[model samples]
Each structure stands twice: as structure tokens, then as C-alpha cells.
Target: MAEQVTLYTNPMSRGRIVRWMLEEIGQPYKTEWLAYGPQMKSADFTAINPLGKVPAIRHGATVVTETPAILAYLADAFPQAGLAPAPADRGNYYRWLFFTSGPVESAVISQACGFTVPDDRRPMVGFVDMQRMMDIIASAITANPYVAGDAFSAADIYIASHLSFSTRVGSVGSRPVFADYIARMTDRDAFRRASAIDDEARAAQASKG
Candidate 1:
């Protein structure tokens, strides 16, 4: 029998990324929507995640937390969905995927918060400046149709969401490549559906006040 999958998430958090991944994989999983504030820090939720973060999942007896782990696990578990690169492409697949989640995210957050490493220690930070990170990401898309090469794998889901979020937060400049990439990802049926649901959830929450 297939395992029962339960997703614990709050729409306002990084859970949105998990939501997008779920939609991309076309899976039927249960969602336990969590309210923010004290509820997230409750003992029950803390048992699932000691850090009290959103976007945790339970697949049968297996409990997975962290956004990147969830993405990678979903792709591997649902091979028919074609969410991952083939074994031969695993090197590059893992490379860019971690790059986006780690360095790219770190650099963008730093820049958005107006924090900077010591001028002499910049090279040790593992990411070029934000503009350079944006340029490298943009150039990657321009050079290849998707983040992990030609195939539209889960890497694109991660990368696309990062680009979209960065653009919205003004961390990424409005370069042509960035704009086009956002348009491409947003046009996807799965993304549209996920976005509509998110919008509806937000609107409904606002209506209660």
C-alpha cells in the first residue's frame, strides 16, 4: 500500500515552496494548515520540528523537514513525475539545486537586509555580490533552458521560486532574463493553481478580521 502523506504547513511561510513542489509532482497528499504565532510554537508542532518552523511532512513513518530535503525527497520518491535528473545528471542536478538553496538564498538575504561581509573577506563568503549572483543565475537560464539543463526537473521549481521571490523582494534587479524566467514559471498550470489557492487562502484569512 502507498504511504499516507501528511504535510504540515502555513501558507505564509516557506511552506509555499513545498506547496509548489507538491503541485509540480502532482501528488495527492493531506495538508494540516497551521496558524501562526503561539500555535506554531506549541508542543505538538515542536515535536515535529524542534525549531518551530513551517513546511514539515510525514510520509508513513518518515517525517521530513526543511525545504530542500522535502524537495529532494519528493523528487526521488516519485520517479514517474520526472522531478529529478537521471542518475547520469545527478552531479549537476545536486550542484545547482544546492547553489540556489544555499548560496543564492544566503546572498540575497544578506543584501536585502543591507548586511555585508568585510570588504577584504568578500571572496571567502562563497557568493559574489547580489548583482553577480543575479547575473550568474540569469546567464544560466539564458545558456540552458532550465536550471538543471534541458529537462524541466524539480530544480526549476526551486530555482524559479527563488527567482520569483527575489524579484518580488527587490533583491534581484529587473533584468530581461529574470523577468522572462518569472513569466515562464508563472505561466505553468501548476504554478497558477498553487498561486490561486494561496491568494484565496490569504483573502479568506483577511476576511475574518
Candidate 2:
């Protein structure tokens, strides 16, 4: 029997990505929606996540937070889902997974906020800056069809998600590789279903506001 998965999330948050991942896993799970502000700050939600963040999941007694961590956990927890690469081919998997969740995300957010990290402080930042991160990513994707390799894996789901969001927000430039990668990811049925769920949730939340 499958374990019960209860996902605590917000429609407008990174929870969208986790929802998509859940769809790919093809498992039944429950979603608890939280409106940002007081709802997210509420003790009910904060008890599950000390930071009071969404995108946290409880698989039976196991509690996992952070989008990337949740995705990684799902891959291992549901081995039958086939979201992970074979043990021998996991190097690229870990590579792009952490890079996207860490450096690439930082660079995009920093640029979005109109902040720049000087060269002297580059060592402190994993990606250094937006341009450098783009250059590195362009080269990586150009070399491989997917983040992990030829076949789609959890890494592709994660990195492509960041690229998709960055594209929508005008943070990532109009590189053909980025566009093509996002196009492939967004076209999946899992992506469509997960996004539709969030869209409805977002609309309902807005109506109450």
C-alpha cells in the first residue's frame, strides 16, 4: 500500500513545482492551501515547517521541506516512479540538481531584486552573478539534452522549472536553449494538471482577498 502524502502549500509559491513533481510520481496526495501572510504565519502551518513555508510534505511520519529536498525525497521514496537515474549514472543528476536549486536560483533572485555582487565578493556567491550563471547553464544544457543526460530525470524537472519561472518573470534572457528546454517541460500533461490545480487555488484565494 502507498503511504499517505499530505502536501502543505500555497498556489503562488514554489509549491507549484512540487505539485508537478507529485503528478509525475503519479501518486495520490492531498493538498492544504495556505494564503501567504497570516495563514502562512499561523501556528497550524508553522508546526509542520518551522519557517512557516509552503511546499512541505508529510509522507506518513516523514516530514520534508524545501522544494528540491522534497523532489529528491520523492525520487528515492518512490523508486517505482522512475524519476531518478540509475545508480551508475547519478553524477549528472546531483550536479544540475544542486546547481539549479542553489547557484542559479540565487543569481536569478539577486538580479530580480536589483542587487549585484561585486567581484571581490564573488567567492561568497556560488553563481557569482546572473551573467556568469547564464553562461554556465547555457553551456551545460547545450552539451546535454536534459540536465541529467539524454533522458529526463528529476534534475530536468527541477532546473527546467526554475528556467520556466525565470522566463515568465523576465529574469533569464531569451536564449534558445532555455526557451526550448522550458517548452518541453511545460508541455507535459503532469505540468498542465499541476498548474491547473494551482490556478484554481490562486483564483479562489484572490476572490477571498
Candidate 3:
């Protein structure tokens, strides 16, 4: 028997990404919905994630946090799902995965929050040039159907999710390549199931207010 997996998440957070990955892995996992603020900061929750963040997962005795880390962990835990490239072929997989978690995430959040990096300090920031960053992403997505390479992998999930959110929030300028990539990556059964579950949860949460 497989070890039980539990997802601690809020419907509206990046937990949705983990939801999608879980669906793709076809694993039976339990979802514990947490409201922001009090519920998330509660001691019980903090014991699982010291940062009081949603989107942490418990698989048997292991605890995994951080969106990208969770995705990578699930892919490795369920290799039959083929969400990760073979170990020797993970150069681009690890590259784009951490790239999205680092530079892409940093740039989008900073831009959306109206924070600007000083021109002199551009070198210090990983995603200093917005245009250049988007161009690089576009090149990668357009170069192949997937981010890592010819095969769809966990990297695609993180990349597509980030681009979808960034474009929707106006943090990143809309581009045909981005839209195309998101559409292709999300037009899967797993993605649809995950989105529907989250949408329903989101509606239910809103109705409670």
C-alpha cells in the first residue's frame, strides 16, 4: 500500500498548483483547507510549516513545503506518473523549475507590488530585466511544446502556472507565446479536475462570508 498523502492548502493560494500536480500523479490525497491569517498561523498548522503557509504536504513521515519543492517531491515520489525527467536528463528540468521559483516569482511579485529595483542594483537582483526575462521564457516555451524539453514534465506545471497568474494579474505583459503555452499545458484532464475542485472550494469559501 502507498503511504497516505495530505495536502494542507487554501483554495485560493498556490496550493492550486499542488492540487494539479496531485491530480496528474493520480494519487489519493486528503485536502485540509485552511483560511488565511488565524487558521494558518495556528500552532497546529505552524508545527507542520513554521512559516504558517498553506501548500505544505505530509507524505507518511515526510513534510514538504514551498510550491516548487512540493511539486518536485511529488514527481519523485510517484515516478510512474512520469512528471519528472530521468535523473541524467534533468538539466533543463531543474533549471526551469528553480528558475520559475526564483527569478520569475521574484520579478512578478516585485512588479505587481509596485516595488522597483534600483538601476545600480540590477545586477544584484536575479530577474532584473523584465523584458529579457519574458523573452527567455518565451524562447523556452516556444522552442518546444514543453519547458524542459520535448516531454511534458513538472517544470511545465510550475512555468505554466506562474505565467498564467503573471499574465492575468498584469504583472507580465501579455504575449501570444505565453497564452499559447498556458493553453496547451492546462488543457489536460488533470488540470481541469484540479481547477474545478479549487473553483468549487473557492465558491464555498466565499459563500461562508
Which candidate has the highest TM-score of all? 3
- In the order shown, the candidates' Cα RMSDs to the true structure are 1.6, 1.4, 1.0
After superposition, the stretches of candidate 1 with alpha carbons farther than 4 Å from their true spots are none
**Model 2: per-residue Cα lDDT over 54-82, one tens digit each:** 88999988999988899999999888888
Arrange candidates by lDDT, descending: 3, 2, 1
Q: How many angstroms is residue 192 displaced in model 1 relative to the true structure, after the best TM-score fit?
A: 1.6
Q: Is candidate 1 or candidate 3 better by lDDT?
A: 3
Give the Å error, residue 17, model 2: 0.3
lDDT of 1 at 63: 85
Clashing pairs in 1: none
lDDT of 3 by residue, 83-125 (tens): 9999999999999899889998888788778898988898888
Q: Write the per-residue lDDT of candidate 1 for residues 1-209, one digit (tens) a residue.
A: 17867889876778788788888878788888888889988999999999888889989888899888888998888888898999998876788788888889899888878997999998788788887787778777777777778888777788888888777877788777878877886677888777777778878877877
lDDT of each: 0.82, 0.86, 0.92
Candidate 1 vs 2: which has more TM-score: 2
Comparing 2 and 3 by TM-score, which wins? 3
Instruction: Rate residue 111 of model 3 by lDDT.
Output: 76
Tell me model 3's lDDT, rounded to 2 decimals: 0.92
